[model samples]
Target: MFVGHAVFAFALVAGAAAVRGVDSSRALSLGAVAAAFAAAPDVDMAYALVGVVSAQTTDALSVASQFWQTGNLVHRAMTHSVVLAPVVAVAAALWLRGRRLRRRRELVAAGALLASVVAIAAVVSGGLGLLIMALFVAVAVGIAEGTERLTDLGSRETFSTALVGLVSHPFGDLFTGLPPAMLYPFDATLLADRLSFSVDPTLNLLGAFGLELLTIWLALLVSLSLFGYSLRDAVDGRAALGAGYAVSVLLIPAPTLELSYPFVFSVLAVGMVGAAPRVGIRSRRVELPDRIAALCTGLAAVSIAGFAYTVAYLVA
Candidate 1:
């Protein structure tokens, strides 16, 4: 899976967490950081794809060839795994320390801006794109952490939220068909391909544009619905944030919502954060609950194994 796919998923979940005010700023920053971490694994292809001295066309592999070749370098490997997560995260955080501006908000915005740039560049040039992504997250986390340490924001909450964002990163990728190679020495397998190539382009454009359209529609409906509830007057902020999260999560099960789920969800999630209810949005947060999240994770693991088995059987 591409970094964008995982990044978008983490962004939505983390961003949603933030919008609800559960871990607002930290979650948002972590979302960006997770995106970077998700992206770091694929930076190697940078040499073959991106040109330096002169403008060069990056069409070394045909579509099918590209798909197959990805398995050689892109999938679960050195880049994707639990071991590399912290290593990459810390490196990214340190590098970003130099770019620190006075304002934390400004730092976050800059991190987002930088991440976007790297993602786009990777898509076009096709290098070790994930490295750029990793950098993006590092900067994001560093911005938040540095700011919290230096500024007035509570450090414990921000750090805790950032931890959540980081932990959730890999799980989101597994669902999107990109599992990190966290246990490299013990396990050598990379990824089990459950998705189609068509899903890629479709999700890309849809997420890039479709999300903007849906957010507006969803926002209007949510705002109107809140008019009738007595509690709406008190929980107006929470209601709006809930509505945004609902829209994002709802998009997950849609039939056409395949690879694009993360991106669409993320876009909607960011909007939801923007629309977040001002009260205790964080306290009233929505999560899958521990038991359910674990169950889902277990099922996902089995599914991947089954997918791999089927593929190997067919090949054999």
Candidate 2:
């Protein structure tokens, strides 16, 4: 779902920008900025992590519980609200407007980073935890800046593109889990129930997972289209088919971590299918067929890992 948010945002913005006669390079940069904004709401997960650390929850189950509990309040809260889109866009526009002010921007960013660290320290443990988190944020910010610089995207353009993603993000959440508080602060009400294909296991085994897969595939296809690449050029049909087979494991009914025999067998079947030869090696040049073979091999390895994990879980 996290990846879906980013990919969908990128594709949506890129496609729109292209339609508006934007250059490919600029469109890519705008898409990246939009994707970043779309995924930004998940920054609330940091709050959950801080809670876990503060509670000293060492066990897996305890940690998971704390994570989900915090997530329920913060995940689709104010950050994911429709109102946040314009607010963020305005801020981004102001920050990135006019000539680049590298020194001033760096100073402001550093100050904000320090303040965030101080706030987290007040809530969570100070010493090592605060330092670690501060370092993490610094690194993340640096990476983001580097990405923007690489794309050579102006602030105004980026902010304009980001508006679309920010606004769409909350609505997109409706397909997966609980709908976000689109009208937050003023209204804490959920916009709608999740749009599920079928909750019944017998009727629809894919559930939310299927929707996520579809979202990811659709996003990928849109992105490829924007980049002037055909589906065949961008993706290997054989590898895609292999992935489809592997995903069937998720459909088999199993209680949480418990794996049924059918699920286990499906995993093995997927592995076997992925491992099967679909292309022949001829020349030294790396062709699409070779890439397809490599993709299949990777899928096979993943399926094997899943099979091993299921067996281990069953034994435990």
What are the RMSD figures for all models against the true structure? 15.2, 7.8
Q: After superposition, how far is residue 223 of candidate 1 from its true place, in Å?
A: 14
Residue by residue across 158-247, what tens digits does model 1's lDDT show?
Answer: 344344444444444554344555453334555554333244444434333433333322332232233222322322222222223323
Off by over 4 Å in 2: 50-66, 98-148, 188-192, 201-207, 226-228, 233-237, 240-316
Give lDDT per model, in order: 0.41, 0.56
- What TM-score fits each model? 0.36, 0.63
Worst 10 residues of 2 by lDDT: 255-264
Question: What C-alpha lDDT, on a 0 to 100 scale, does residue 245 get in candidate 2?
Answer: 42
Q: Give the per-residue lDDT digits (tens) of candidate 2, residues 21-67.
A: 88877777778777877777666566677667766658765766677
